[model samples]
Target: MIWIFIFFMNIGIDIRTLMDARYSGVSLYTLELVQALCRYGSKNNYRLFCNAFRSRDGRPPRFDYPNVSVTDTKYPNKLLNYGYFKIGKRPKLDRLLKTDVFFMPHINFVAFSRGARYVVTVHDLSFLRYPYFFTLRQNLWHRALNVKKLLQHAAAVIAVSEHTKRDVIELCRIPEKKVHVIYSGINERYHPLSAESSEARRVRSAYALPERFMLYLGNIEPRKNIESIIEAYSLYRKKNPQSDVKLVIAGSSAWKHGVVHAVARASGFFADIHFLDYVAEADKTALYSLAELFVFPSFYEGFGFPPLEAAACGTPVITSNVAALPEIAGGFALLIDPHNVAGLSEAINEVLNDKNLQQNMRERGLNHEQKFSWEKCAREVVKVFENLNSIY
Candidate 1:
C-alpha cells in the first residue's frame, strides 16, 4: 500500500522592516500584519526571514507560536540590496525554507527561487509623484528598483489604499485585478481619553505639553507639507491674536527638515510653536488624545495612518483632500487644499471657534475609525494568498 501526506503551504515573509528598531509607517504596518497573521492564521506555515545584522539589537522579533518560525542571516542590508538590484542576484530564500509563496511586506524584494510565487506591498509612489522632495540618491534608488517591472512580475500586488491601487493601475499600468486594496489599521492602544485621565496628565507633564495645542505628529519631511503648515499657523496666529492655543509639531527630522525649522522660526508666533523631536511610542496615544485639534496637511500619503490614529483617539482632524487622505478622513475631517495656506488657516480658525463642529467631528471620526482593523486587513491578505496559491 502507498500513502501520501498533504502539507500546509509555507508562506515566507520579508521582515526586514520589523527588525529595525525605528517604526515608520511601513515598519508599523509590518509589525501589525505579522501579529495579526500569527493570531488568526493557524492553518498556514509562516517563515519570517530577517537580516539580523541590519537590526540595531541584532535580533529578530520573537513570535512564540507553533505555525510561525524566524529565520535569520548575518548578511547586511546594503550588500543584499545592491546584490539584488545591481547584479540581478537574489538570495536563495526558497531553498533556505522550501517556501511556496514569498510575501514582501514592502516594495523592496530580494530574489527568491523560480518555484515560489511572490507578492509585494506598494505603500506609496511618493518618489514618482514628488520627485523634487527626495534626495538624488533616494530618487536613483527608487528608479533602479524598476517598480514597473516588479509590479508586472509579482503574482499579486497589495496596495494599502484604493488611491494607491489606482496609482498602481495608472502609473505602472498593472491590471486592476492583480492589485488588491488592503487598508491599514490603527493600534488598539489608540483610544479616546478623558482630559482628567492620570495617563494624560503624566504624558502632559513628561512632554511639557500645553493645556490647549494643535498637534502635527509624523516625520517632519518636505512631502508632509510642513512648510505650508507653518505658513498657515502663522496666518492663524495673525488672524486670531487672542487665541492662546499653541502648535505642537512632534516627530523626528527627515529630508529637508531644515526648511520646516526655518519657516517655523520666522513665524510671528515662534514662541508658541513647539518642536518636540521624536516622541516615544508610549507617549503618542496621550499626545493625540490631549490635542485640541490634529492637523495633517500632507501633499500625498499611501494610507495616511496618523489621521486614522488621531480619529481613533477622538481628536478632530484637518487633512488635505488629495491622495488617500480624502477617502480616509473625508467626512470626519475638514478637508482642504494643502497648497492653500490661507484656506488651511481659515479652516483651523473655524474649527477652533466652533465647539459644536469639534464635537461632531470627534463623534464622526471615532465611528469612521471602526471600519479599519489589523485582523480584518490580515484576513483579506491571507484570502489573497489562498486564492493565488490555489490558482498558481
Candidate 2:
C-alpha cells in the first residue's frame, strides 16, 4: 500500500496595509489573495492580524469563512512597529497569534519566533532600485525596516513575477531556491463593457471624460514617468493636428506630483488633456472601456497591473518595454522604450490609426488574461506553506 501524509497548520497574515481608505495595488492584492486563500486552502486555519491602535471602530473587512479568524489590536502603529523592530523577535508574532506560519502579503516591520517560519510576498523592489524616486522619509522607513535583513530571514519570499524573483535573488542575495514566482491575477470585474452601458455612461459623465481619449492611470509620480505620456501625447497631436483624440490622466497624486501637473499645463495640447483625479474603483472599468488605448510609460515596475487590467477590459495597451511590463503584457500589448518620446508618440499614432491592430490586441488580451487567476496563485502559495511546514 502507498502511504501519503497530510497535515494542516494555522497561518497568520499581517493585514496592516488594508486599513487604507483608498487601497493601493499591494493592498488590493492582499485582500484578494487572502479571500482566495480561504476559499482554496480551507483545510488550513487562518489568523489575520491587524493593528489599529487609536480607532475603536477600526477593523479589517469581515470574512464569512469558518476557517478564517482575525486577531487585531488598537495599538498605535508607530509604537507597535518600533517595538517589533527594536525587540528583535522577543514576542514572536506567530507565538502571540498561536499560529504555525505567518505571512506578510507585503514587506513591513515584523518579528517572529526563531524557529517559526513565515512567508513574505514582494510585489516589487522599486524603492530599492530607484531610491531617488521615493521621498527621504520613505527611504528612511525602508531602511528602518532593514528590508534586506527581513528578506534574508524570511522562510520564503514570494515574488510576483520571474523578473521580481530574479531581483530578489540578485539584489537581496536571497537564494534562488528560496524565492517563488507567482503572478498576480486580474480581477474578474475587469472585462469587456459596452460603452453604451448605463454604468459606462454614468462614469463618463461623472469624470467629464472625452469619448476618444487614451488613458494613463496610476500614481502621478516621477518614477511612473507621467511626463513622458504627456510629452508623447503633445507630439502626437502636433504631428497629427486633425486627430481629435484627447489624453486622460487619472489616479491620485503622490510625492512630487506637482511636477506632473505642471508638465501637463505647459503642454501645447493642455486644453485637450483632462486630469480625472482619483478615479474610483467602480468607475475604472468604464474609464478603461472608454479609452481608445491605455498608455503606461513607467520607467520601472516589478509587476504592473494597470496595463493588464486595461487589456483585460478589452482596451488596447501601449506600455514601456522596461521592467516586468513586457513579461506580463508582451504578447498582448504594444511595447515602447520608456525614454523615447518620439518613439512613444509614433506608437500612439500607430495604434490610434489602426483599428484592426486594436481589435487584435483586445482579443489577445482577453485570452492572455485567462492564464492568471487568484485561485491558481492561492494554491501555489498554500503549497509553499506546506513545504515549509513539512521542512520544519
Candidate 3:
C-alpha cells in the first residue's frame, strides 16, 4: 500500500469560504484533487495537515474521507509572520506526521520533520514576475531567492500551466526536466445548465442581468487589467449608440481600496458597469449562464480560470492572446491584444454582431471544456505519488 501525506500549510476551507474568495482557487483545487484521488480506489492511505489560528471556533482541521485522515498544527503555536521568516516561539507541526510522500498544494518553506519526500505546486510566478503589482511586503515574502530555495528542495514541482513552467525555468533557473505542467481542473458543477426553467430565471433575476450584457469574472486587481476592460466597454458603448451594452465584474476584492471606487466615479459610464464584492459557487453558475458573452483581458495569468469557467457554462469567451489564455481558449473564443483598447472593442463588437460566430464558439467551448477533468488530474497526481514511493 502507498502511504501519503498532504499539507494545506497556509489556508483551509473555512478561511476560503468565509474570509476571501480571491485565494479560493488553491484551496478549491486541493479539495477537488483530494476528492478525485480518494475516488480512484488506489491502495493508498492519505493523511492531511494544516495550520489554524484560534481553536475556539472549535472545529478540527481534519476532513473525513474513506482513505484519508487530517490533522492541524496544534493550537498555541500558530504560524506568525516575523521580519523575514515565520518565526514562532515554538516550531509548528514541523512535518511531524510520517508518510511515504508529502504533497504541498502551494509553496511552504517550513522544514519537514525528517526523511520525508516533498512535492510543491507553484500556481504562478506572478508573485515574482509582477513584483511591482503587489505590495511591498508580498514582494519581500515571495522573493526570487525564496522561490529558488523552494524549487531546489522540491522532489517534483507542479506548474498549473505551460506558461508557469516556462517561468519556473527562466526565473528560478530550475532545469526543464524537474518541472511538470498540470492544468487546473474545474468542478463538474460548471457544466452547461440544462433546460430547467427556474435555473435560468433565478440566475438572471439574481443579478438583474441584462438580456445582452458581457461578463468579466475575477478579482478586481491591477494585474487583472480591469481598467483596460472598462475602457474598451466605454469605447464600445460610445460607438454603438443604440446598443444597450453592460459590463459585469464579479469576484471578491483583494485590496478592497480606492482604485475600484475611483474607477466607478471617474468613468463616465458608471451606470453601464457593475462590481460585486462576492459571488458564491452556486451563484457563479447562474452568473455565467446569464452572461451574453464572457471576456477576460488579463494582462497576465499562469492559467486563466474565468475563461475556462465561462466556456464550461456555454458562454462565448473573448480573452487576451497572452500567457496560457490561448492555451486554454484554444481557438474556441475571440483572442485580442490585452493592451489594445480598440482591438478589444472590435472583438467584442464582432462577437455580438456575428450569430454564426457565437454559435460556433458555444460548440467549440463544449469541446474545449472536455479537455479538462478532475479525474484526469487526480490520476496524474496518483502516478507521481506511486512513482516516488516505488523507490522504497
- Among all candidates shown, the one with the greatest lDDT: 2
- How would you encode candidate 3's per-residue C-alpha lDDT over 67-144 as one tens digit per residue? 666655543222433312534333333245555667777775455554547777788888778777788767876762
Give the C-alpha lDDT of model 3: 0.72
Reference-based TM-score, model 3? 0.87
Query: How would you encode candidate 1's per-residue C-alpha lDDT over 40-94 as one tens digit per residue?
Result: 8778899998875545663466788899998877777787777776788867887
* Count of backbone clashes, every candidate in sequence: 0, 3, 0
Worst 10 residues of 1 by lDDT: 52-61
Residue 285, candidate 3: Cα error in Å is 0.9
Residue lDDT tens for model 2, 256-281: 88998899889978889998778777
Order by lDDT, highest first: 2, 1, 3
Q: State TM-scores per candidate.
A: 0.95, 0.96, 0.87
Clash count, candidate 2: 3
Off by over 4 Å in 3: 1-23, 53-63, 76-95, 194-196
lDDT (CA) per prediction: 0.88, 0.89, 0.72
- The true-versus-predicted C-alpha distance at residue 297 of model 2, in Å, is 0.8
- Candidates 1 and 3 compared: the better one by lDDT is 1
